[model samples]
Target: MSFAEPSRIEPDDNQSRGIALAILLLPLTLPLFLFLCLFVFLPVGLFAFLFSFTGELLFYLSMWNDGRTLTRRRLRRRLAAGETGTLIIEYPMLAQGRTHAWWTPDDISTLAPLPIPDRSSDEYQDAVLDLMEQDQSHPWDAWCWQEYTSTSQGKASLLRVWNGKKYQEWLARHYPSIPIVETTSEIVRQLEIEAQQKSHQPQP
Candidate 1:
């Protein structure tokens, strides 16, 4: 029997960081050129005027380009790392069709609001710290999807090892009737065992 699909594993319809950074810096060069012409040189000749404009433009352009290049490099590093775990999701209160969503999951090295132990054992605290640090290392992987009413905070998803029972419960409660596909090793084995049991049914 086919199990339900995991609710969170859906295709993203958004621009990646590389594209966003490139677009952001594309027009910055123009202003740089204009500034250089105005302040750097006050000459009357055509060549001086042209040079000033070009220099200013190039200056701004260079800054913009540098910023974009840095952004792209960072984005590439994150993407190539196959970094996993955690996303802080934000969506609108109400949408006409679909909500406009944006998240900085890739660069997130730490997610706030995690449960912190108070005066606990050093060992336990250390472990918690490790988990939190790991969570930050790949914020994009961990996710919490919430849907709010016109007012009030929406329900938060339960922390489930991906495709585990907790995730299934979250789907059943929040999404309702949504299929929960178990992709985790433990859950998959449980499923396989159940399947084999059903298959071995004494002739119906």
Candidate 2:
């Protein structure tokens, strides 16, 4: 089955705040290291030199001006391969300087059955909801989709998002009876099986 086309939301300029911070800190490392080397122990000097170079490189890599495009391309490939579902949410942690794993649909589970109240359509609400809203039944409010943790074994976790309203609407308009699951891991797993089977099939 084909998956919904993934759209990469461009991080707003405000999101560049992290990059700005990284850039500002990048230049200060040398002077700080020199000062430390001059006033501190020799071991401190060696460690300072090594850590300063590594830190600057990490900052540049994580906050490069082109990093956003790299992220978007990776996401597009995953989407095209039917690798994401409604429950998948990309977590970008700029403060920590890392992109968390893309959460998959199958990873979501319900803590209990509870209705997700409609937060939209309210008169006084903001133009956008920054984080995802979940059905109260979801076990965890935020889960790393697609990534399975040792603690998550056997136990189901909750998956929630905008509830795939747009994707469902598009599918309904195109193929009214299409069966789209909340997550994509099962589909991808099945696809892998099918591919292996086809590869092993005898040639006519």
Candidate 3:
């Protein structure tokens, strides 16, 4: 949370004109926006997502951006009520389905989820690591660049490689002091136990 005073963008002094303009525009733009979202986007998106990885990224990115919007909205409401303190939000990492705890000040700042490519995809190595869209410096601590795969039982599993290309530069640049701690042995043990328990269960 930034202690700096929030910049106020004063609305038009003539409220009636603004209201009239909105009234005029709503009938024209609302339907068009809805049309694009429903007919054009949804219809095409359903098939595109199944056929192309690029489409999958676009769809998920939109959802992540929407999440950021909600986060910002909640932060604004809190700030408006004279709340000030460190704000920590827990979220799943963009690169993988794992917990990521964000510890930062109680400002309205938001981190948009990164568009990380799937580890098995050809573009994984070429994936851009830029965070310029958020208009803030990279918060390296907020990122978890692990890969995930489905286990035999359809459960999610995390795979963090110490020398994974996607995260090598990110680790060195942001988290120099924090030693790498993510490992798979514990997860492997957990999965093995789960398998054994399943095997012991009576068959239907």
Task: Mark the regions of model 2 whose C-alpha exceeds 4 Å error after superposition.
Answer: 1-33, 37-78, 81-97, 103-204
Q: Considering lDDT, where higher is better, how would the candidates rank from best to worst?
A: 3, 2, 1
lDDT winner between candidates 1 and 3: 3
Please, what are the lDDT tens digits per residue for candidate 2 over residues 1-204? 999999999987876998898888988988888877787877787897778566545533543333321243543465567653432222222122222222233413342233322222342122123222321111222222213311122122222121224444554565453333322222233334566789999999
Alpha carbon deviation, residue 139, candidate 1 (Å): 20
Model 3, stretches more than 4 Å misplaced? 1-13, 52-94, 97-204
Error of 2 at 45 (Å): 12
lDDT of 3 by residue, 130-203 (tens): 33233222222223211111122211112122223333334346444322222112233344566689999999
**Candidate 3, position 70, lDDT:** 24
Write model 1 residue lDDT over 51-101, tens digit each, in one string.
Answer: 756654563354344431123244336535753322222211111221212
- Candidate 1, residue 132: how far the Cα is off, in Å: 32
Q: For each candidate, give its TM-score against the true structure.
A: 0.16, 0.22, 0.23
Ranking by TM-score: 3, 2, 1
Candidate 2 clashing pairs, residues 3+ apart or interchain: 103-145, 104-145, 104-146, 105-183, 108-157, 109-157, 109-158, 111-137
Report how far off residue 176 is in candidate 2 (Å). Answer: 21
